[model samples]
Target chain A: MISRMRILDGTLLALEAEGMRPTAARAAGWRRAVAGCGIDSLETLLPPAGAGDSPDRASPVAESSSPPGNAASRRSAAPERPPSLSELIARVLPTTVVPSVSALANLASGAFPQSGWHCIYGLGDALFADRKTLARSIDSLSEGREALLAPCFTNERGCATALAVEWLLGGEDRAALVSFAGCGGLAALEEVLAALLVHGGLPAADLRGLPELTDRYRRMGGGPIPPAKAVIGEAIFSVESGIHVDGLWKSPDLYELFPPEIVGRERRIIMGKHSGKRAVLVKCGALGLPVTADLAERVLQKVKEESARRKTSLCDTDFIALYSTCRAGKDEKEEGGRAVL
Target chain B: MRFCKIVDTTLRDGEQAPGHAFSLDDKVFLASLLDGAGVYQIEAGVPAMGRDEQDAVCAVKDACKTAVVSTWNRLTEEDVRASVACHPDIIHLCLPVSERHITRKLRTTQAALLRQFSRVAEYAAGRGYRVTAGFEDASRAEVPFLLQAAETAKRHGIERIRLSDTLGMLRPSSAALLVRTAREVGLPVEMHAHNDLGMALANSAIAVLAGAGFIDTTLLGIGERAGNCGLGAFVAACREYTAISPLQARKAERLALPLLSRCRQRKFFT
Candidate 1:
């Protein structure tokens, strides 16, 4: 029944934290891409002076504007008395920006100044805690205020997204703080969105822009996206094994969770050591080549042998060459059988 | 927290990916690393492929000191006979349990498939092999049929049941429900999660939390299409839920880095 939700993407902050300074142009592209995916807002970590660019200059969707220099430097400069939340809010209010503060549950004890801002309470070690304890902790922290729970683990281990989705499903309706590709130890924005779209009644069109967004992310100096990466990997739609290819041929829904077109990808049949006759037939049909069962079997055998020897799937050129050889062999066999008769 | 067994399938299912073909040496080396990292079992390879694959499985079994070596097989006597030649500690039989896989892919009815599985399970069990049933495409299966398959496994002395999310279609809630329901049959459930929708790791962890006894993993999540759950990431993710030692998890992560780097340098992933 939860309807109202917001997604705060932290891809820009994640890039900066990884020591890659994204240009204003790249930032603008990133913003446009995410906006197309229906993201509510973008979160950027304000870099120090002369950091080469500013997200405010890049896009108007960025909601927070903090003082220059990282959080660590600011905290170290006034170690004797750290700036309170109210003091930081006062500084951010002059710029007409509602400050967004991220803090752990332990540090988020006191309350004050009901200003128009959101506080992201980090789940920290409580993410590893048992379900009951974790739920109690979440309820206690966001009991009376507009607090968004942030599932921040140390790495992109599996739990952050699951924790975020669980909170979104079972906990109260609230904004979720996530990062693209799960950078900066936050829940992955793509995964959370996909989950909501598929299981939580969100629009399927919300994810059609993931492929372009991923490409833009790579151009922004993000690390190489693993081909097997969930939601956005290029190779995810490629089918190789016999059972999978057969299942997909019968019905894509049988073997696929969602259609590839939903994420702007196409289904591909790859010829490999595990390729079956059905896969070869499907590939041939897609290539606009007509073939009988006999030809398909011969071509399939050759495809398997060559793929096993090469230790990789065959390209279309390789398959076409193998098909020609098999066709010639079949023709010779037919001529011999006719002569014998 | 319950201790979930780690079943490293890097040499078997991980090799099924298009670009990966591990040599005999690579198999043994990876098996040794997994053993040193305290993995509960290693699914070495499918023996029905030929002598080279059998030799690789045998080599891995000989190289590992603590981890048990297992072989993957289809539900048939021929596949079981091939696995027996490798002398693996466990024989895993993969069964397609979903209606689509049962009627369409397998071209058989549910009862017939289960009958085939029963005959094969009895054969493997009679050979003094520890048999495990892998319900392939179990996520799309009906709950009652899945439980029936689990019951059949238990009846035939099958050691464990592997619930495979073959299409990586499960969310955490569904994964937890599947694991809990399977646990009701009084058999240890192992999760074989795929990452097509990018929820493999999350589903695997949630399965563990929901009473699954084992989780399957690959070195860098390499497998068919998107891949299976990653070994290093899964260990790191389930640290609080499972009794895996932190030191052992660190060792696995450290070994995995160089191995992954080597694979990357060799252009295995393209």
Candidate 2:
């Protein structure tokens, strides 16, 4: 079995790092949406002080003359357990995927509260146990109705991929915990999501809003996304090679498996050292300066040499400058021909 | 399990990091260090970049005593000429097997790429040079073409097949399948993985488990974009399978940390 489907949003804790605070009303709505989407828990790093945790939200006790607020305060003062996000999420949802960065017995027990969590999320080899011992415990945990053993991962070697290997060995009942870009942050979330969709483990349409989530993190002071970060990189779809351009013009799928539109990106072809003459011809056509076949070769040679010297792709401005030079030479030749006539 | 050979490419692909160039001394230092760590091969550098690069590749071949020296080349005669200039132990020839690399990168079709590799492999092999044919992005290549490319190389006397996850898109399951399939063609397989999807170390490890005969790595996994598998980390993760004593792995970690930090100016996790 694929285990009961649930996507616990772990972004709340990462949001705290960016100094963004969720208002009480927003928190209540967010929690409601998460629950509605079948996510069993809100995996926040810090205890959520959201409206979902407000005393007014929980059902009130009977036989109390005091106002609902006073009775709620009285009950809060004599709590049976310390405040925990896992408990908070469990109260509203059917299942929780608790965050356990460590393997402390106290933390594990608290994170995986009885009759609440659907699974435990942590780095693969949660306590550095060998594969055999780990598999045994995972099997034991999964015995209950819809209890999943999810191994969390970052970009660290043997991260999610290693967990996947173990999961395949252990069977599909196991789950995987991963951030969008393979880290706790939102950057590269969409790209990583795309990879997962392509990797054949999850339904592509089931995933939503990786780019939007990443944007939210950036707005919260997480900083701009790394331009070359694997999947979501700015340059991932951009190509400059003549052959790439030729194939891309024929079919984008020829080079990249998924459409850039999958992640809200577009294809681009810039002129560079590895560029072919077709690229030059295309650029010239775009500029409305149709080049003769001979001129195309000369322009392409110049572009390649200059890109090599610069050790980078030529910017549009550089291409324009080259066009201007060629255009001026052509104009002068035409004038000389007129004078000869 | 086959005893996997370790080929460190820190000086080659690692140096290809955008806007980064390593001096001769840095190349010599890394080559010697990897050699001391018992790496079976060191892909020193790309001699085809220029004469200076060729000279540096030559210098690396001379600097290391234990590890066999090699240079990376594309499936072209000019590049083979450059590798010839270096006079190294193995001429590592590369051909793009995926439709993307063949059509876009080389502007050639699969048939053309196969034809080119046959001629290039023959040229290098007939010269009495030890040749290793790398199917760049073999993970994305059509299965039939990949097998055909391997068979052609095998026919041309290529000694090894380097199956690279060029885009780093390979998963452990697919990696095992690809490596196993390539082995059937009768050539030893090497796993050259990228960390594009953050799966390099894991993919390499799984490939080793699946019977690939060599694992490609770079120190700190520093290369283009995310980088290749880190030598120290790969050694640490597969220490038992690779047969290095824990003490030796620890020593390698110690030597790699300082140089890696100096190279990239960050506290790299690997």
Candidate 3:
């Protein structure tokens, strides 16, 4: 459950590519377009590798480049290239800001639409390498620096924290770039919200928009994002493993930061390789399946085997099949269904 | 600052994602692309899966013109025989090093495990295929013992040892330290990390900095559970931070990544 005030989302570009629908304006009218997601001209975002391109994009994506000394690649003279960002952005709204200094420079030079576009200067540790020059570039950008203020975060790696503090104290209008998860940005976002709630002279009323803010984020990430992703993965509420499952079963608050209902997700007892009998019993009980102790243990072993065989946690179909197999002497067959509660 | 070689196990580890198995054609296509991208080595797939699997591995080996083709296996002659039949350049023989895995997973003593592995590595060496021993769950193994195991495997003709953070439990600092410690065994250490904590990238970077000669990665980091370090992410970071060869970065940039729809499909967990 998200117990923070509000976090500016950086998922628009990612979500747009996934074809997720645009959400309504938030209560605060803040745009859901990620700060670094919007592009001026997708083609010109990165200079082409050859003439108007970055050196990396010099090769055409269709013509695969074979490594040197290989007869096939020796014939072609170039390796297969990765899809350009433009090609990738074709399906989605090209709203993500170009975090690279080079791409950001291109963005600053290009003419962007007046409305629905907010320029965020993406800065991570790379800024530290040339802080003075990067700072000068930002200071020099005359028109849209006000719109710019996207800081690339890499965990609590000090730089992101320092930049956030500077923004808060220096009165910069920039929003802290919060990745829904990974690179350490998720926890940082919570910290930022906590600080703002306490220090920034903002009232709790201002913080009420976080849930809506979170919904906007969900919209950008598309439907049913991975359950285990750090901040955004739904797997947070779905407990697996014996120790944590037992603890959570004993006291809901013992393991989780908040209730799963807060995030519109439910606490699932997933029977996995490391799952204890409690997880199996809970999941079975929820599905209204009655089983003796031995049956539960048998079902659990089957689940672990299937999970290990498939190299993932068993889904609902797997659970049902296992339960049915345990109940009767019949063999289990793969079925396409899930254990959704 | 030394350059690191990449062995992409997308086909093998990536395919391990629950309900995600690529058709042979997809495997061949991905192989061609990865090879063309100058990926140093391609751990195509574990041929031990079966005949069709063997044929798939052979097809990838035949299709590639440059990338070194390899296959994974357990510490057993039957799996090794399957690996040999596929005709890969390297046979990756995996053995558990951690006490938990040795006791709970493999249910064997360390001495018995080592002895059995030596036989497998020796058999693989005699078969004219280069052998790389994977120390499964090595991070949990005692440092000195792990190095000793590597040295013993080295003596048995295993050319390399892959240090797997099998459970994805190592911190970046510990990952680096493990690589540094494994360096004493005098064989190239390949870092095979999992992403349980989303720190696979950080751990991979630290391994590169700490002198792991090779990094085991998958395209899009598609592997078990949280997945492996993404090939694109690892290459991109390397390009930005280190003096890595531009060949890799260029290929990574231009490679038509599988669409998010495919990646996001619950089946494939990249």
Candidate 4:
């Protein structure tokens, strides 16, 4: 049978109850015994001397806190020591209950091994209902440059709300990263977490609010950006039924969590079935087309009709030629290069 | 400085080159050849490319003994999952880090792209598989973006970050600078040079000198477009630059030439 060790039932219990370590408790008792009225000698604190000692010898005061030639000290120091478990739990519990979950996280990672103490912090299981406790936990966790891993529960509700709030407060990088098990219920949230996990963790510097933060997270998550997955959605970026390719090229801060350089690719406006002159003019002008809007529109109409007949997207060369003719200021009625209008 | 891993992507990217095809026998033969050549890694192919590619990757998986076999993927979870079926020691996912490409092709922001890449990287890492992130077309990517990608990959627990000159646009000096930058960004760098400018070998040399531990190459420099730098040239160059005894370098140099000849005979000439 496996033996259970209890640290609370021994003489060490009173000391432990006062939040003192076993070694400290022993030293305190030894000091008291040494100074006491009746028990002036350290021997009073120690077990009785046995055959191992000379009969006429006076026991050393220094040896009193230490176990003598008896079974007591061995049992006390053994892994199965009675009060160890409870003492350990007590020590850990208080630290774990610290409002700063972030610090607790650092302790777990052994990041601050020199701290000489592993803090006891809350698991956030029951404390989620308490905002003050939750806030405290977040503060504790975010205190140092330590990383935090959010422990996921059944509903996955606690971390999601906490993280969302943290992001809004510009605490995205400092917030605990939700565990991967939480990915399915909150796809978007998990996407953010997944991205963070993938890229290792967000750089503490570039972290920001929801749209930008989530956008950054989604890229690292490596889940296929669905056609409609918020900022990364194919549709969110592409212009629909319009000519402008849209948006500034650099300074992702304005665009929300991105510049195009994240991928070795660029945007190209492709004229298609729904092409119009204004759309053509806008695309060409944005990309530096020299053509008039009216002429560009006429050519775009013809190109659209041709693409519809052929059931294919307009090729780059075709679009280029059409744009070139319009920009060349050709007459609308000219035979070879006339604008379709 | 303590450990250097030279990964050969001959089988994977080489196959992607036009006019290059390898049968099963060819794969086993090449893998055995690579093993004897002391390559630390061999990227077989993207497993999900097709049944044949997957089978080839599996065959490589079974054949390679001394080298860690790996496969390629996009920075996506599905790609990683599919690539795992081949049982490689590593899965290499490519992400584009240049602003032009990110804006024009992906139409997404770098911040977002990085997030996606990180998620997939961690997922792959969590599965107990070594993961390497390839910054495709890294030669043209802005310095800040490239450094960020490298740093990000390091944080995500990737085994290495490969800076690929997808268009083979970098010179040796530039390649060296990038490799050094990658090291400064705190990443184990790998160089994937193409011969688009006929300087693939030169660039590969620069990468190594700049602290790149891995260099992607093909047998006899066989890859896309102008092909990659000749592997033979690289081994020979290392023999010259490394701080080893001249006698040892001479022997290595001599051995590499014959090995190069044999590889060409079997892989191309034959």
Candidate 5:
């Protein structure tokens, strides 16, 4: 079902903007990851030729093969450089068997040939426009051609993700322009995919490859993803509050809309200042530790004190140590009472 | 121009986030920044946490020149008494409205819970304090019961009714419906959104569009789970729908960086 929707990802462009060299290997890896996530296309906007210090040195083609000679003398002989962007795209395009490759161009410029490139219009004040106005804009600019409306992430009007999803849900057969992890202020590929699945009735498996894609994104210098980011945050499934833990224990549907396994994640119970005795007992049970009423109470008290003192949640090691200490204390008190008896 | 009041809870709910413990100085500084950013209200803290917390709340109250200062409390006389000692501009009493929270968490029936809420709101109002009733987890509550609870708040002379999406489980459509339903009670509705689903900003924006008068926010969206709706993000997202000034938004954005730096310096996420 996701094949019916078109998604254009601009992760390579984002990487280049972050000062990472746009190598053939990085592009190929990105293509594989995007394809694995069921995305339709990969979009990149390379720097204009001759913009970098040494176009030849930065070119992936040059990196692959060069005539054996003194590099300085060769450069001095002819200071001409090939169209590196075209060469890089050509090299990377052949490897993407699933998703097609496209170039990025600004809607205002109208210079780049629109045959194989996606034109992006900046949604400035239009972000606050009603659905009718936005539809008219999309239809007028698209003009029977595929046009991708990109939101100005710096615009103080609204959220880029919400705008993109609104457009996608409202438009008919309109392609979405996004970037992995929402880099470069474009809509995030993962978040949009999750929204489509939730709102558009797309198949759940469409998002099953997120955990792997997340790993690849980080490996490709996409920076650390926020742990609480929507749909793909690593710690989104982790619960800590007393009421929430108890509710999830009673019925997961009471708290979670979808199971964590839908995104290849698992539920985690965190012990912190807000944790209660029920959480301690559940955590102890999960860890295969013996739990008594008094022990659970004492351990919870210790957890709250320690988490408050450290200003952070307790790790498994810290929880285990506290449990052991409480158990030992209980044993000591019992022994002292026996001596008195 | 339509105006949506901004209530910044960075010092209260934001500090409830795991790994985030703001000292009195941090609370005072953040409160001043939020006030400078033109927030209408600041939920300082829970005074019942002890003398230190009460002192922090008072310091934030003193530091704010424009914003109204408020304190969060449970539906109990003891909590209200503690809040009164702080002398905040408003006292907010949180009552659980959902069946799951009321019966399972609080172990009480809906009627009993409503009675308790009425008693607490009346008690706080009788003390000559402006009182607000917060319906914790109202997103999951039955619409009829939620409306009834809203009526009870209005009957008690409560100034406002806050609908808290405690679990952050609402999408835009559901959020709009909840806000619309709550607005029918003829009392001002405030939306306190959480970001567990990453839709807090979207939900808050929709709530404003759906006739809610107040929106709750925290700096950098820091709160218990994913966090509350972010002050900067919400202002940016709802600028068209709300009367929040662009200058104030820029000021809030500018202050957010230093708050982030402070959190980073303290290694809040570590």
Candidate 6:
């Protein structure tokens, strides 16, 4: 079974980044939404914070009455014990097509999550343990549920397509099956989501914001959506990274051709090589950091230095750290002197 | 050189060869084949031609993923609007840069043509389109006028400019010089050469090496008269020359060849 703690951690992180309080319902909602939308591992799903004790650098917990925000303390907290493999089998075996010998061993051993749909597309040898593993699992599944399998025949892979079609047909149980079309790769993911959201009892209008979610998925996979890609292309809202972030921020609606809520994402200011000083200053004003002409210049210089050192374009965290460092400093020398490394 | 964005205009301009025409399904099948061949851009059609052209553009736009879809437009605002209706990412606006064509075909003074084009381009830009302005017959245009047109485009914010050798009159050396001149004006250059003298591919290669970021090609080199450079042939040449890296060359061949073959196949079937 997928570790509940890991799921919780991922949900909490996505929630925190989205600026929502980490209540149980919010956590569950995020879980349900993410579970419905994708099949990536929990670690792969959330935006990475940093390597090794990178310090809880998310935007200072907004309106915090509680000490040590959820992320701050959760990082050091003990890992929650995951439900045993047998326990997971007991919970999910009832939802599969057939329950057989080897399937019991794998499910009881907790190789897969107890709940939530699993959609694996492309190269099943790498993604799934083996076809036998899938067959055994299908055999062990309970009645009234079916597992969809599409084989790749003659260079054309039908596995992903068949799974997707079954997932759509499976009805209110809401479990889904999906396979990759080999040619489309991750390209078909959005179409799958849109098709599912349209035909699978999902609120279609609510899914109008799916483009942003798909964009987030693309970013998570480290893919660049071509500037002209529909919905979430770089050129749509981005006017050369930071140079236009504030302008985009002011009229987020204008820049937002797609709604933000469908995939539980928000438009953010990304600091990069092309960010304008006015944009930085404006961002500072929003973050409650006082700004001046000299400060903006200093910030820009710091950004350039840090970005070069890190070998990445400046991100929101870098901007926040610079602002936070400036807040703690008394003079320009102290403000500018901190090592970016 | 960096990975150049190769645009095959085979289905659009290729089909425009004197005795050639592609049915809608033929166009879609050819576009799909091109999509697999790994081209970076496809100038699909001239939408202002009619509804049939617009339909071809729509079908290709809906299905293809390997390359960005673009449409060719003349320097008129009406053409730009018509092209916009089909939703191509890049609208390639063409204007005659040569004084001979400007004085005769356009029946206007050089200064008047420039002003009119500038106004039309400004409107296109205001609409937030990525405009690629092509100087039709650029190789024969007077150097100063070519420079002026390019400078005018750059000053008015055109993203890319093309130097079309209308009659394939230039050799590789002249193509290189013309491309260098365009780049000297600080605008990205795309080379569109005909093969009247069987030098389109050679000129394209030289132009690319001289800093042109884009090259236009037609399938099987089919076009008016002796046709343009064959896109598949140009891709192979770029690969052999290592003009672009192995990865991109491989990608271009994969994305462009199948569509070209499909087009040929459909022509046979029809």
Stronger candidate by lDDT (1 vs 5) = 1
Tell me how many clashing residue pairs each candidate has: 1, 2, 35, 61, 0, 25
Say which prediction, candidate 1 or candidate 4, comes out ahead on TM-score: 1
What is the DockQ score, from 0 to 1, of model 2?
0.22
lDDT of 1 by residue, A1-341 (tens): 56555555666656765667577688767777787865443333333323223324433323444211122222223223433322332222211111111233344443422323453434433334566755554456456764333333333355667656666666445545567888766677787777777676455346788888888888888888777777887666777777678888887877787898888788878787777889989989999888999889889889877876765667777888888788877776878733211
* lDDT at position A201, candidate 6: 30
Model 4 whole-model lDDT (C-alpha atoms): 0.50
* Cα error of candidate 4 at position A234, Å: 38
Predicted structure 3, TM vs. truth: 0.56
A26-83 per-residue lDDT for model 4 (tens digits): 4344334223312111122221222112234332323534211122221222233234
Give lDDT tens digits, candidate 3, residues B1-270.
Answer: 466888888788766554444556767888887887778789988776667678889999999998899998978999999999988999999887877667665677888988898888889999999999898878789876797799888798888889998766555556878999999878988999876545576677778778888988887676655567777777766664433354664465346355212433442122
Judging by lDDT against the true structure, name the best candidate: 1
Assess the local accuracy of residue A14 in candidate 6 as a C-alpha lDDT between 0 and 100. Answer: 26
CAPRI quality band, candidate 5: acceptable
Give candidate 6's whole-model lDDT: 0.53
Model 3 chain A, TM-score vs. native:
0.45
Off by over 4 Å in 6: A1-341, B240-270
DockQ values per model: 0.46, 0.22, 0.04, 0.01, 0.31, 0.02
Q: TM-score per model for chain B alone?
A: 0.94, 0.93, 0.92, 0.86, 0.94, 0.88
Candidate 1 lDDT at B197 equals 55
Give the winner by DockQ. Answer: 1
lDDT of 3: 0.58
Ranking by DockQ: 1, 5, 2, 3, 6, 4
Q: Which is better, 2 or 5, measured by TM-score?
A: 5
Candidate 3 residue-wise lDDT, A151-187, digit = tens: 4343332234334423443443343444333222322
